[model samples]
Target: MDAGTELEDHFRRVYAGNVEAILAYAVRRVEQPEDAADVVAEVFLVAWRRSRELPPDDEVRLWLYGVARRVLANHHRGGVRRERLGERLRQRLTAVTGGDPAGEVPERLAVRAALARLPQPDREVLMLTAWEGLQPREVAEVLGVSSAVVRTRLSRARARLRELAGDELTEPGHVLDVMTVPAPEEGR
Candidate 1:
């Protein structure tokens, strides 16, 4: 029949023939099952788009393997990049807070516990201010709210954190102390 029908038929046949092998290849390579599933989906998407360019007969399976290999490589590189970025952020936070960068500092544990206890909205406002160094107005912009709303949320979040964590929540060297301290009111 038509060119579109021919292409769809070919794509369906290729998918039926190779999806399992591609999935197996991905599962063996990736740590997470979801990641393997993503790899398989991406490989088939590429095949569908470049169906005309697919090799004849059994060569198609080898070509699919090559595509899967590249996808896995990209996935690995992204994971590594994320890990490095997280490490650098940890180092910066450690320098600023004057706490051990390792995960076992007692003050850090207290702060984390207190933060985790807060509602998500309050927690996000505090994190944006303390960790990201965003001002109330900047946080408002990021969160699609008014600056006044952000300030109110920040104040309430601080109060809640103190309530949950007690007055002696963090040491002077903690990032929470530096960032969560009350600010002077705007416009006298």
Candidate 2:
């Protein structure tokens, strides 16, 4: 194949193979699915522009993940803006829910409140593995860390969540199970 045909094929294959995972990763990081789509678009645009410099498939996957990490960092730097917008959204939601948002169920509210109290990194680790259904290795790739590190973080995050939930949550594979649970629909 000529260079153009080769590039097109590469792009097609990469997009087909990685798009769903990338979008899922982005959704776990960002508040809006639209924002996640934008991040994915940016990642692919960079891949297209730098195709000449692209590595083989395995390395390209890592590179795309790095791009996503940077995109999330950029999003975080706009934290105040996002917070203000979130507050406005919360207000609107409260209004729609008739202002008694908890609505007679204290346990669910307590769980959500406890979740909110966890550190951001812990939450990210939990969301990446649980909600996104990524294996520890893949979670490490997204976090720009090693698999061992991901495993350690996952352990600690689950422990913290269990503590916050006021449950013993102690089982041989409980942490792994927690990490594999689907993410709640509200945030990601």
Q: List the global CA lDDT of all models.
A: 0.83, 0.76
lDDT of 2: 0.76
Q: Which candidate is the best by TM-score?
A: 1
Task: Give the alpha carbon lDDT tens digit for every residue of 1-188 in model 1.
Answer: 99989989998999999999999999999999999999999999999999999898679999999999999999999999999989877666555556544654655667778889899999999999987778999999999999999999999988787667655545543447633423323332
Q: Which candidate leads in lDDT?
A: 1
- Model 2 compared with the native: what TM-score? 0.42
Which 10 consecutive positions of candidate 1 have the poorest summed lDDT?
A: 179-188
Instruction: Estimate, for each residue in 58-128, the C-alpha lDDT of model 2 and write its tens digit.
Output: 88788889988897788777776879889977766665456463443454454556567788877887788
In candidate 2, stretches whose alpha carbon ends up further than 4 angstroms from where it belongs are: 79-188
TM-score for every candidate vs. truth? 0.56, 0.42
TM-score of predicted model 1? 0.56
Q: How accurate locally is residue 149 in candidate 2, as Cα lDDT from 0 to 100?
A: 88
